[model samples]
Target: MSAALKIEEEREWKQEQKQERISPVTFTTDRTSSGATVYNVNRDYITHINVNLSPGCASPEAMDQMFKHIHATYSTPSLSVTRLPRTCEPPSDQITTTYLAVDPLYNSAILSIAEVRAMIGILQIMMVNPMLCSSQYLPETLADLKRTMTLMELAIRAYRHTDLVHSLSRAISIGVEQCRGLLEELTLNLASYRHSLASGALNLTRKYVWARAGQGSTMDALDYKLRKSHSSFAACLLALGYAAWPELKRGQLGKDTLDELAKFYVELEQESTSLRHIKVDTVIVQDHLGRDLPVPMIFCTSSQDFHVVIAGFCSGLAGDVLIQRGNYRILNAGDQVIDPKDFGTLFEPGMAVTMSILFYEKVEERQGIEGYSCPRCQHVNSRCTGWVTCAKCNGSFKISPEESIVSPETEQHADTDFIPNERSLFRKISISKYAPTSRRAAAAAASPAIANMAPSEPLKTENALSDGGVGDVALDVDDIELDEANMVEMNANTADVGFGEETYGMPFYIREKGTTNYLTSNGCRRAEGTQIIVHPRKNDFEKSAQVFYIDSYGALYHAASGLAVDIVDDVPCLRQLRPVSGRPNPWSHPLPEFSFINSQIRVKFLSDPAFPSCTDDLYPNGSWATKTFLLASNNEKDFHVHPISDFSRWIPTSDMEDSLSYDPKKRSEKTLRVLVERRTKDVGGARTSWEIVPK
Candidate 1:
């Protein structure tokens, strides 16, 4: 095996051992218990050189001698240092934590070209002391360092632009050559010293060579490694950043580099593949093609969420008949569309389920300056939105729209005609007929209830299994147990009460429990059936109205002013329920109003009361709940619930694999703690606890 492979294997073995030896630990709500401390880490000092030449110590005549010494000691194109009189103080808050050096002199010290470049990059963003940059008493040695820094900065900038790839590559080549030349010079000088020792001009040749050679060789090896790693990282960044450019196709990279990159790419692909399974809840459709038809398959992956669409046929027919039956050609990996029935036998019941939905793409034409054509869909438009609509089928949707995009709840009647009928194409199966009558029956059965619940919604809510509710066979006990801890926690004894006040503006209230009265934000009150304690700001009923108690399911139904009820349980309940007298209705029109339980909490829509309820009680069949919540929005399209699975896939940069794997013990000794505080309007008000912890 290659040396690289050997090193990697050994590293993996060490990591496994390390993981096995570590014990599991947890953090509680309390401020302090047991954990690594962040405060213990110490900052290193950064040295600043002040070149002051005095008449008695070093006169103007000694300038030439100083220059000779600097030239002989430091290997560089030039030698100079900026020197201005100023006290050296530590870095302050103006500096960003990202660029802060772990240690000023030792750990983060610049010993070679790679370190120099990295340090310059970091320092560029920092608020530097003006005295450090000024050349009031500039040393000659610092001038060369400045020159090198300037070149590196320019190279990095050029590398960022679209048209400077070739130039950047050439610059890197030159830098590598310069490094090689420096190493050769050091080697030659060492040989000369050895020759002097042989002539008895130098004493202790072995020790001298051992000391110098050891330091030089070690530094050289480190420099080389750093440069190589940086180069590889840069190349990857460039490739991924400009992947859409046609010029950067696979052929652009030279053979050896391409081979190395391909390996890296394959590794990334594997990682993404693993992540994809963890990130999505995909349904497996068996016999996707007709029994006699040969279906072409193309499997690809991306960093975003998307739906898969397949096309199949019920019977062999010509183009027009095929179109009428909603049977289209099957497009394969190579983009070739073939007859759906030509390659298969008659599709039997459960042969395959084919449907159409918008697939995800990487480019958006509508947003691009000069609309770029999508490589996935081959369509050109204004913005590169990274979504496409099937021109042939008229199915249009973004593959992965930004999280902020508003998706309003669809009116129940709006697309009734468009709903696909599975029974029309597949063998008619009675899901309800086969459903189990008891919990045990449900657990062991493989009936239609399982199929209905598996693809539509998640099987369990926060406390389904714990509550001993049985509905669909797809409902797993494990999933219910996993979600039980997250179930909503609310005060159960609170009775439904009315506070005749306008809900449009912020409402404040005080509820008396026992002898203590607790002042709380009316915003915290949700659910119709529960009576909430409200402390009115004013006693005038004409100005401030009493809040009313509505039914509860953790949703607050309030009759407020300026609010128009659009869809209440899929019905216009505005005309049905009017606000009680003494209640200042601030809603746009008199309508039944409801509040979201919490700003952070989202709930899923189960069914529309106006329509026949779906026979299957469980909607989804996963370990996590499938629920949707209405996000804050003025438009109907603003409310949509993302699947829990999709939400989990969005791991932030701070939670990347490396960051996640890094144990706190491995970090510097900085102990972090959580602090609890209580806030209230009065000095001796009822206490509500809040905790603060390190991010």
Candidate 2:
């Protein structure tokens, strides 16, 4: 081995040993844990010592004296370092390092206040710079950048507190302007797309709008290729931008803005990847950005513009002004308030302002009949006027003259015997008292004779004797006895009548002067021999009072109050009763059974014809007399025959008894009489004397 090579090896071996023995200590400057430098401490201590050590211990400022003592102690050397290594060499050039030390005594020695303050200032600046940039160092880089700007502002405020107010205001204004500029750019893009679509260029409009929204910068070659391979990549980017910045909402591309955008990706038919269809209508850009944006430009599509404007109106946005346009007069939802001049700009001539206009026009075309004419009187008029009188017939009508005016009176008279005289009859009976009494007595006296005659018997019997005759009259006592025996047998064979059963007999007759009258048990008066005068002023058959007749069987028959005779001078006749074995007697009419329940009178009548005949008599003219009677058993103390010429005045004998009982605890007779009278009056008839009789 050569000397040179050995020397080189030795040097290398020494270098290796040196590398292994290198010290591990390294020194670097940093902020003190208490955020103050040693120089600052020393300076404060020196100032304190100078003030207190100069004999001020007993002064009024004793605290200041104690502080001075502390200062003196800190100013003096507490410990000292004599020597330190000057320089160090790298053993193998593997890494570089530095070391430092200070003489403890000198470092602790008194420092000038100015030098201390200067060092403190450096430390403060260092501390604040890191805080100002802390936002940059946080986890989210973009957010941190924003925060860094805010922190820098705070730093400026803290450092120069008085000047910060005006500076911060200016910075904020600048930030707002920047945001506004960006928003304006977005609005322009939206408007451009809308204009293109309105110009009938759908394809170009979509390409330009989507490209501007999705690629903030034109796509790189690789990015374009990747987007083509997975078109969803571009859509996702566009959605992200729209979410982050509400301004991007204007660039959504499609003619049917909401529908087209929703189907944009789906219509592309790129099925090789997983991507959700984006619904533009449902997409909420403003919500993501936490700011409200102007109405989206995509809504300006010709069809969508009208809908959006109408909807705005319905939502109560400037509705009054928006609805004023003649074209958009029929206000609906989504309408926008634009000047009439601006409305022309929104739509071209020949295009309908709204579909609603057609509907309104159709409604305006229908016209209903406004006037009517009377059919009967030929009166032409407007308005129903509720009721009117015919000019020709003087008949009242409810129908409008234009539609149908009818004379109901003439029509009723044609169909029925409803004479005007009947109405007047009600008023005549209401005033007259004598008409009722004579009617009832005549009915009662004739009932017995009427019941004895057969219904088929001739109204008159013939007399064969001459006016002058001389003859030998012979009486056959056997014949008289046989006739009497036959009469007794007939009376014994007569059927007994019950409350709900019938008796039969022939009607009887009566003769007055040269005229004969036929009276039926059913209370019909038939004049056979002579005419009975019917007073023109008094004969109102319909309003004539009713009269009830009691037959031998004790059943009632009803008769009309007015006499049915044409001769007013003739006296009326009473009829005789005749018994029939099997047939029902008209005089034995059943009375209605009635009781008071819950303050209302409830009546039950026998519906079967096998029951006693009802006092319903029909005259030749078709007017009938009806008698309704209430028969009650509970209150009956005794039976009584009550003659009532007016059916309306007849009251139940039981109700009268209930009222007239002597017992105080029972119903009072006065109350009963009063109630009966009231009830009789309600029925509208005149009553005769009531005769108490044994049942």
Candidate 3:
């Protein structure tokens, strides 16, 4: 090669190196011969540097050191760096700078990279020193911390836009490390008051008796401080996420570090912010998909009243349905104290129920925003001016209430118990039969005269016993003695006087004097002359039992019939009273209204020769839908009545299987096959015993 050619190549290489040394901060994309994009550096133009530092951090010594470092790093004549003095006096005490052209949309706030680094450095100095982290310095420190984070976010955002995030890598790394340090310091601070930060009753105790006069106020202050600290800590974490985006994006942060940050974010969102609330431990609730929810209910107990905060089917965080049902109580564990009225009677020791304090996210009205947020559906209505109906849920709400987004009553009734059939309270049963005919019949079958008093079906015989002569069956003399307590008082002398107010007693099964039978309402048929019958007593006979209330004449009136029980032709029947005046005076003296009184034919049931009879034929043989049980008598009569064991009396079989197994899902599926056996003597059980063995 010629010496002249070698010299030309060498000069070109030297010129390229000199150009790279004083490269422009900004660059333009150019296409190379190979068709690959290349960023060209224009070194002829000098890049100006602006350094804006906080007033408290920018001492003369600090400025000189910073200047020396900048001058040493960028020694090329093409670079011009300047440090603005505090005397320049920006608009406010707040230190700000603007980065131009990096973000074509808007100039980045905290203009220079130098200002961001300075703010981060100041935060680090204050964080490291224990004395500087005192209570008096917290507020100022938090404000600065948030401000620095915002500036960092803007810088990172600008760099990202210009595809120059790598240029701020070092700054990003330092800022993240400082964030972690601040988080650690804040965590320790919160830990110092962990007990107070936890949710519970903040009552004055003997330990704080010395400061009793100021205890309430002290507790209030502490609560506020703790909440504020938490808020600041959360804000710091949020800022860290923004500042550490470059590292997070490139996977520079370790899995553990990333996981820790993610966990913190999740906890921040899940943690309840309410002052005093208890978490439900065992949720007997299941969602629509049949998943168990740990904290399915939110209840608030104020004064003596308790109501649900959130319940029923709701949209979950991920859009899956969260179906919660039933009432829940917070069970106080160990030394914990909960108000008796709010919870209930003291839960027995080792009661599987457990509880923890809960917090709630209080819904507040949004301000300075162009939308009205629905408290119910959380749908935003940006176009609404005053009262508006939510497009999503069709729920109506005022633009914003005079005081709150939701009224107190509206909140309480938002998600309550599901009422079946009843649509509007104003609609009466007589006018509309919205309830299904099957439900009415099922309900009537479950509890005879309680719902739908006017029976739609005829009386059916319960047992295949003869309606023969009562004289055929022998009666025991001792058992024939009637208890005076069971008899209703009938004072003919005071019949004219009124019993100021009506009185009713607990519903009872009226057992006849000589038989193991009760006075049963044949059916809820409102025919005037239907005679009440005597049926063999079964377990839980409240469905067939009677409720008696005292009338104005002190006479016992059957609540279902609104008539007094009287002996008409030697039969117990509901009888309408004869009116006193010829015109049936409306208001001479207020009397009970008698709508109809037809002398309908009566029903009679004679004692069966076989005292206790079988009801096997009575079972709906073809209907598998109806729950069936067999209650066999020990005497071989083989009575197969529906067995509903009153767990209070039955004993477990010698095989040692638990007969008291309860499963909420399969409630109708019986685990025990009970046999009603009569014993002459107490061999190992009661005379009228139920031998219940696992089915």
Query: For each candidate, what TM-score against the reference?
Result: 0.19, 0.12, 0.16
Residue 611 shift from truth in candidate 3, angstroms: 91
lDDT of each: 0.28, 0.26, 0.32
What is candidate 1's lDDT per residue for 1-695, written digit by digit as tens? 69999999999778656644544332121122211112111122112111222113345357557645533433221233221112235544331111111111111112334544444343333213221122222222223233433343433332232223322332333343344343344345434544445545233544565466563454355345444434433333333322322222336434644454455444445433322322121222322222332221111110000011222122232222223333222333332332332122122222333322221211222344354333234355444343344343322223223211111221221123232332123211111001112332333332334445544454532223546874434455443322222121212111112211232223332233222222212222222211122232343341222222222212223333211222222222112222111111111111222332212112222121111232432223311112232212111221111222322343333324322321111111111111111111211222221111111
Candidate 3, superposed: residue stretches over 4 Å from native = 1-121, 127-133, 136-286, 290-695
Compute the lDDT of residue 138 as modeled in candidate 3. 50
* Per-residue accuracy of model 3 over 588-677 as CA lDDT, tens digit each: 111221110011011111111111133343323312111211111122232221121422232323211322331111111111111322
Candidate 1 global TM-score: 0.19
Worst 10 residues of 1 by lDDT: 298-307
Ranking by lDDT: 3, 1, 2
Clashing pairs in 3: 97-111, 98-111
Task: Supply the global lDDT for candidate 2.
Answer: 0.26
* Models, CA RMSD each: 29.6, 50.8, 37.8
Indicate whether candidate 1 or candidate 2 has the larger TM-score.
Answer: 1
Q: What is the Cα-based lDDT of residue 428 in candidate 2?
A: 10
Over 4 Å off, model 2: 1-357, 360-364, 367-695
Q: For candidate 1, what is the lDDT?
A: 0.28
Candidate 2 residues 440-483, lDDT tens each?
A: 22333344444465554422222223455433332233323333
